[model samples]
Target: MVRGKIEIKKIENRTSRQITFSKRRNGLFKKAHELSVLCDAQVAAIVFSQSGRLYEFSSSEMEKTIERYVKFSPDYFVPGRPQVELYLLELKKEMDIMVKKIDLLEVHQRKLMGQGLGSCSLAQLQGLETQIEKSLRIIRSRKAELYADQLLKLKEKERELLDQRRRLREEEIRETLVRPMLPVTLHTGKDETGSACRMSKHSSEVETDLFIGFPATRL
Candidate 1:
């Protein structure tokens, strides 16, 4: 009959448990040695019996393997100290300092904006006033620059508008020059007074100051 597989559980008998521990510890050491030799791998194993006896296996020196483990597996190498946790602790401390600095800066900004002045001392208030004066100077300087820029832009726009007007006037003059002029014929007749009178066919009924408002035309 074939032997059945053993169900793994804690051995209840003390003597049996001790025997099992001894056998398993030796077997584990043997397996570790075989794996190291077969795979050309660095291996280390440590065990402690219930009686507080140390058992260990290593492909090379135990200290050397441990050093390698610590080097590669820095996170779980030492029980008391974790390198990653130490770095994170330092980072957290730096973050806390930065947060405090930001908070102080925010309070300073609030004071500069004329808020939160109730908690300030006389000297603090004076310092804030100086800062406000400095800020005002800077603001005035920037404002002047902006005004200058706006004036320059306005001047540029004015020049552009003038150039456009000039171009339009030149175009109008060109069209006028190219136009064909109409010939005028004067017809003398006797009016109600029976005096010599002249009438123009092209003249409108409403009179205009032709010399002042219109170009001189050939009569």
Candidate 2:
């Protein structure tokens, strides 16, 4: 039969309570004895029943174990000192250290802003000046680099604009070169009967020669 897990509470029945206490007390003593023998450790356990029955177990003299514990404990420990007081003392020391660090940082900040010169030696002041000068140089160099980058972008944009203008001019020139020219025709006056007459011989000859390329140059 599987036994149910025992709930950790005060046993109500007197008979069951006594049985449980007796069983647990023996178990406790057995565990202490085993722990001492296996681990080579000193162990002590003491318990009292509600009816003033005493139960005790110890691997060595219990008084000697207790004396060793007290001896190894913190020197500042006392019989009535609360544990919270020790924590509070540690916190106060840490707060003092933090306060000192904050004060030091504030002084450094003032020095960086040129406000703590009164306490600085000549060499310290010179070092501070050098540091500031180096920082200024770095800042100025970075600023110049930024400006140069912007100038380069502007120059590139200018070159792009120039190239676009040149391409447009070339396109315009090509259009002009490819344009068709209109033919010119001369008007001759009509005769009295409103009928067209042949041009004068000289004029006809000149027109023929001009239009036909000098009769193909007989020579």
Residues 168-200 of candidate 2: C-alpha lDDT, one tens digit per residue:
999999999999998885556656443345445
Off by over 4 Å in 2: 1-83, 183-219
What are the models' TM-scores?
A: 0.44, 0.43
TM-score of 1: 0.44
Q: Count the backbone clashes (under 3 Å) in each candidate.
A: 0, 0
- Judging by TM-score against the true structure, name the best candidate: 1
Alpha carbon lDDT of each predicted model: 0.80, 0.79
**lDDT at 140, model 1:** 100
The CA lDDT at 95 in model 1 is 58
